[model samples]
Target: MDTDRLPGCYRHPDRDTGIRCARCERPICPECMISASVGFQCPECVRDGSGTGHAPAANVPRTVAGGVVPADPHLVTKILVGINAAVFLLGLVAPAVVVRLELLGRYVEYFGGPVEGVSTGQYYRLLSSVFLHVEWWHIGGNMLALWVIGGPLEAALGRVRYLAVYVLSGLGGSALVYLLTAPNTPTLGASGAIFGLLGATVVLVRRLRYEMRPVITMVVLMLVLTFVPFGGSLSVSWQAHIGGLVTGLLVGLGMVGPAAGRTRALVQWGTCAAAFLLAAAVVLVRTAELT
Candidate 1:
């Protein structure tokens, strides 16, 4: 018999294989072959005989970062967008809410309400500021970027990992702003988190073996624009952008780096915790200096 006439794998018809599933007696390629007590079996046979009413551990689908593939990959992105929208709407009605939540290192109320800012133990501002947006154009630009970049990232890194990157990135931005900018200067926007997502996107795209030019170009352009005077009146916070970018790059490396399985998870979360602690340390140091 001509060897070319050999049957192809049932699951992958393009690949010819000599081995057959022990249970189903169907041809299977190496990728589809699972070692059994007697002989190799197909993935379907193994799943059916798993006896646990679920796919075996090996059969469960997982994201690149080892997160279980979720049913709705974009769910977290949608929720985040909703939250930012809600906060924006609330700010529209109660402008004070924006003032209360905006990232201020230190600001004294001239009216004698109270001293307010992160330096005054209002630490929540580091994160709350991320969701607070007052300008229509500001919210519009950020939400658009978030939906476009965050959706694919959430799917690749999984929801928990994605959310961690976002929050930590925002904190990283706030921490840098606190450390570098004047205590009285107030800065607020989601650009920091968005920069973080862009950083992470670079890692994901590289891992998937896609072209790097587009992403690299975008990053360089954004970084350059951070310093360029838009109209010589409004200035962007270069510190926050740089801080978030570095944090995202570090976290992204941990998520998709060489580590595998449990080690990958450990490295991923460890990197996240380290990034958070580092930002917290910066905040503490800045607060100490301010007070």
Candidate 2:
């Protein structure tokens, strides 16, 4: 009949139970636990915590609980921009390595021989192509666009989701290229994924109910830039750009709406999976035709 005489702390067996953590079922004294709105949580639980495997916590921001938010958006933006700029700078210094690294091919009939081997099946290009740019100008332009858009999107969507959108869109765009293009021609750049981020931004800003004029203007500018032919010819894989854009739009839609709880999370996962599968199918069919 004595509640004060409960089990000692799970972590510190010497201590008495002062409170119960709703999450871990461990007894925690006041000194060992912080009072959350839902219940007490140990310091460790709060720091490296995963969601309850289904529903996310409602009171806490999704990004906060997910630990995806960047502490410094400006710094992150600058770091990414700096990396891309440095790569372009290096490209200018070593043209042959840049050409090979960029994965540009000998002719439109076949993509870069080495990269084509990797990209032929649409396996390697999904991730590798993003890091490879056609030229100094190609890298610079993508980096500049990333500078202008990536920071804001990362700030709003958190680094994890922003990165997810960027990568998935890039993969989606690359898949489109592998499917649609003449398999012999080589193409490389982050433009597709960058365009996808643009598409994601359009969805995110609108969902957040923020003014979308800037995002619209930026998209228009990028589209124009895409067609201006900066990479020396029409071998730039515009199909990937469009594919990434569409992928971003779909992912962004899933991310939108204020349903951070478990119910909405399930829906988001399903929707995202379907979209990715559709993209993969396109890649599969196109690769089969090429080989």
Candidate 3:
């Protein structure tokens, strides 16, 4: 080999790069070129060689690969927070307009509400209720919990799986509410799904055998928030919390099961589809009874 023309292989001196790394402009042999975002990275760079860890830049929105310590790759936290904020804003504005316009549509019922009575065709509430909140504090608390857990969970579980857990958790909570609540009572909030995130976290920690401090602390705080009465009457829904937890348990078990290696990739997608179908059936049946 010519000594002056960089003795090492174009990709790696030890190895030869018939190809080059798309990112760092280094020669990479076929063996070293591992697939990356743009193209491929060298073995050294790919194998802890590159110092640029995937952390989101401050104030800049970007996605990282997996849940690392510095910044979570899963952007589910940001998206969920944005959604809650948007819905809360709408809740505030729509209430005013709904009052003035006398639109029955202004009221968002939870869990489809009463199977029969004057109230019928409000079936959409089963799903829409997840986005609705009775007050600012309600949304704020739930969103905060979501921010704490969702990112880490999403980072640990990929984005698709994270979303699967979220949607299924919400559905599970709603189903429990429907079976348990009096038909006349109305309930709503992301608490159900957020609870599922917490449950999922607990299970993840146990599976991964990481320090239980952070997750345990969060769980304790949540439990306190659920039961303790504050400012007189507490607007807490423990049922939804329990339901979310149950959903998370099922999701976590499926994710960590022996089949995880072979089937985890497609698990979330299937779960999401089944959950949607179930929600639809509930709505249709309730609507029919109401009508």
Q: Among these predicted structures, which one has the highest lDDT? A: 1
Clashes of 2: 7
The C-alpha local distance difference test score for the whole of candidate 2 amounts to: 0.63
TM-score of 3: 0.62
Q: List the residue pairs that clash in candidate 1.
A: none
Query: Comparing 1 and 2 by TM-score, which wins?
Result: 1
Write the residue-wise lDDT of candidate 3 on 111-189 in tens digits: 4541332134444455566767757777887788788788767765666667878878887777666655555656778
> What order do candidates take by lDDT, descending?
1, 2, 3
lDDT of each: 0.82, 0.63, 0.60
Query: What residue pairs clash in candidate 2, if any at all?
Result: 55-262, 109-184, 110-184, 110-185, 111-184, 111-185, 111-186
What tens-digit string does per-residue lDDT give for candidate 2 at 1-291?
A: 875455777778876654566577677643445434454566556554543342334323324112244457456557666666666666667755444443321223224444333344336546566666646566777888887777767766666666677778887887777676656556677788788888988986665444578889988876776667855654456787788899988887876543445555566566678777987788667655555
Ranking by TM-score: 1, 2, 3
Superposed by TM-score, candidate 3 places the C-alpha of residue 48 at a distance from the truth, in angstroms, of 9.7
Model 1 misses residue 281 by how many Å? 1.0
